[model samples]
Target: MKNRTAVIDLGTNTFNLIIAEKNEGALNELVHLEEGVKLGEGGINKGNIQEAAFLRGMQMMKHFSGLLKKYEVSNYKAIATSAIRNAKNGPDFIKQVKVQTGIVIESINGQKEAEYIYGGVKSSGALSDKTSLILDIGGGSVECILCNHSELFWKESFEIGAARLMDIFHKEDPIPSEKITELNRYLEEKLEPLFEQCKIFKPHNLIGSAGAFDTFVEMIETEKGNDVDLRELKTYLFDSIAFAEITDWLCTSSHEQRINRKSIIPLRVDMIVTASILTGFIIEKLGVKEIGMSAYSMKEGILSKLIR
Candidate 1:
């Protein structure tokens, strides 16, 4: 097995990279990089990747390329999901990435993405043998997987995500009740089939990974206090305070405000609401009260493949 491997997740909203090494059956994180590309910010609405957004992504890749060279990374894999999958020029974009940075970004479908999330969760040692539902919300899509004893019973991905939802239904500041209603209706319609599929699985617990769950942990550790466990995050009530605080903070803040705020930026903050909403709904709809957060996901999957 390769001792060092790098995994890059070219996400719709953020491009993330992790350089790690595996030895003695343990994987250790060595390097991490992320940038807000907002690749899917308006692509879902326009059905094409705009020049500005495409250029932003290119610049981010170029920067990442420099970092990879600096670290002398030899075995690395980069994959893009959702946004690139939906883009009309996604093929051209991937070709351009290879030409520009020498990093080939493979476009993966939703089911495959869910499989990677499942791989990451199973490695976390937090999952139980009983039925568990894994929900991973990205910038362009959400994936839900039901598993027991590390085996997947069902999996589904939805087009709803942080940046996509924010662009589609989140026009009003602090998000008006009417907008929330419309969003819920849309989610219900889309999630109903998956919910029905989940009914057969009857998951004993729900596990959340990536995006909003990451922000929730950041908020709790930074705002609530230190010594807070991931379980405390599951106790979140999604009250008006959390909604208003997060929404108001995301809507009114600019780059300068986030520079010194000592919190995860507003871009990540923007997705937290949608993440929380989905989380809140999953708990109520599935009747599972406990949700565990695993910070690892597609990156780990990539590493697993490379190391093996």
Candidate 2:
């Protein structure tokens, strides 16, 4: 019989559940599920998980627990990131989850989160002999990693995630130009160390792992009238020119307009603009010539470890 495993990533904005079986030293995926609970909805920047967010998280976990049991996963790991790690009631929430759903939750720090993201991206065949930068933008944190195919050169997780940025800078439906400038300036200050490292490593390839990049790729594919199968795609080359155009459209569109778009999901409609701005900023600052998107990220990273 195959050994079944379930890995749950309780992210700030979305909770993801990935179930797989170990077979011949490899992982065969059984199920992949995502729930947008918005765990950081009203309290991420304030360093607390709000009451509504807490209830939403608990409900999601209960649902995920049911799925895990249905799959009969022999081994399971539930890991929480950013919002939970920084929240004041995070520990209490974990205790409650264990008591209520019989699922132990482990809250990992930003550095470990970055490592897992790197592992996931590496498994997707994104790494190469030449240096490359891996960027994973989550709801509460953005992980940046510099590496080649073999080893990691540098990695860091910034608190400036899309949800956090949205909360701070997206007061207007269509964010004002002045607000964007402020946001960029804030990012430049926080990412000074990353920029310095970029100068030293000179990594020209920027690989985006999961989250907003997935939506970006979908949007791009739709615009081109292409019938690209996203599941079969391990890596996608992101056209910078097209990315710039998308960013402009996102910044000018209202909430209603964004919701009407097929490419933009309901969960990401509000925060996608901030994500786009951040993506464009990094491309310009790093002088990145090539950009690729990796569908695999933290959950896959966990699976890789278990199978190995």
Tens-digit lDDT track for model 2 on 167-258? 99999988999999999999999899899999999996999998998888988898998766555797798887897788789988899999
lDDT score for residue 302 of model 1? 65
Compose the digit string of candidate 1's lDDT tens values, residues 185-282. Answer: 88889899778987788887777675676665566457766544442233233333554465446445544454555556667755655666666766
lDDT score at residue 113, model 2, on the 0-100 scale: 95
lDDT (0-100) at residue 247 of candidate 2?
78
Q: How far is candidate 2 from the true structure (C-alpha RMSD, Å)?
A: 1.3
Local lDDT at 182 for model 1: 82
RMSD of 1: 4.2
Q: Which stretches of candidate 2 lie over 4 Å from their true place?
A: none
Residue 282's lDDT within candidate 1 is 66
